[model samples]
Target: MKKLIETIVKPLVDHPDDVRIGVEERQGRLVCSLSVHPEDMGKVIGKQGRVASAIRTVVNSAEGAGRKRVRVDIMD
Candidate 1:
């Protein structure tokens, strides 16, 4: 799960090396915390948050994610 988020976000950032993802499962929910270089935040988020939404959609719908509720948080 962590790898998946990293793969999706790393390419979209100017500082690929600065991208980091932390995963935790709590109360049957999978939470992913994504941290990227400050300058690359806008690119990962996209206009009107569409890119962030898309990223969440893809992660939640992935087969490996199973039936768990997934939440992806983009951190500053």
Candidate 2:
């Protein structure tokens, strides 16, 4: 899951090396935290948050992720 998020986000950021994703299980839910260089935040978020929303949708649709609650958080 971590790799999946990283792969998806990295390409959208100016600083691919700065893209980071942390996964933690909380109350039976999978929480993914994504961090990128400040300058790339807008690129990751896109217009009207469409990019972020799409990212979350893709993550949530992944195999096992569909059966569990997966949350994606884009952090600065």
Candidate 3:
């Protein structure tokens, strides 16, 4: 799960090394808190949050991600 997210966002950031993802279980769901360099936030989030939405959709639909609900949150 972590690797999937890293693969998705690394190339979109100017500071790939600064990208971090924290995984936690919350209310029976898998929560992924994603943090990226400030400058790359916009790129990861994209216009009107479209990119972020897309990412979350993928996470939710990913096979082998388990049956638990998966959430992707962009953290500042």
Candidate 4:
């Protein structure tokens, strides 16, 4: 799951090396937090949060067959 998000996002940012992904299990839900370099934040989020929304959608779909709820948080 982490790799899928990274593969989708890393190429779109200027600071690929700065991309960080952390997964935490909370209350049976899976929270995926993605942090990127300040300069690349805008690209990851896109205009009006479209990029962020897309990322979350993919993550949720990838959770297939698992009951855990998936979330994506783009951190500065």
Candidate 5:
């Protein structure tokens, strides 16, 4: 799941090496937090958050991901 989100977000930003993702399990939920270089925040988030929304949708629909609640957080 971490890799999946990385693959989707890396190319959208100027600092691919700065993109980081952390996964944690809490209360039966899978939480994925994404952090990128400050300048790349807009690219990762996209206009009006459409890019972020799409990434969350894909992660949530993954085979095991859908079984539990999957959340994607784009962090500053």
Candidate 6:
């Protein structure tokens, strides 16, 4: 799960090395915290948050079997 987020976000960022993801299990839900370079924050989030939404959708679809709720937080 972490790798999937990394793979999708890393390439789009100007600083791939700065892309970091942290996963935490809270109340049976998975929360993914994505940290990217300041310069690439807008890119990962996209206009009106479309990119963030897409990433969450992919995570949700991929975790269908487990029915785990996934949330993505784009952090500066």
By lDDT rank, best first, the candidates go: 4, 3, 6, 1, 2, 5
Per-model TM-score versus the true fold: 0.91, 0.92, 0.93, 0.94, 0.92, 0.93
List candidate 6 segments past 4 Å from native. Answer: none
lDDT of 4 at 45: 93
* Model 3 clashing residue pairs (backbone): none
TM-score of 5: 0.92
Model 5, 1-76: lDDT tens digits are 9999988998898899999899999898888989999999998888999999999888887836338888888887
Model 4, range 1-76, lDDT digits (tens) per residue?
8999999999999999999999999888988899999999999999999999999988898888657888888887
Residue 27, model 5: lDDT of 90
Error of 4 at 5 (Å): 0.8
lDDT of 5: 0.88
Question: Considering TM-score, which of the candidate structures 1 and 4 is the better prediction for this target?
Answer: 4
Q: How high is the CA lDDT of each candidate model?
A: 0.89, 0.88, 0.91, 0.91, 0.88, 0.90
**Number of backbone-clashing residue pairs for each candidate, in the order shown:** 0, 0, 0, 0, 0, 0
Off by over 4 Å in 2: 64-66
Assess candidate 4 and give its TM-score to the true structure: 0.94
**lDDT, residue 14, candidate 3:** 95
Residue 17 of model 5 has an lDDT of 96
- Candidate 4 overall lDDT versus native: 0.91
Per-model C-alpha RMSD: 1.6, 1.4, 1.6, 1.0, 1.5, 1.0
Candidate 6 per-residue C-alpha lDDT over 10-56 given as tens digits, one digit per residue, 9 for 90 to 100: 88888999998999999999999999989998999999999999998
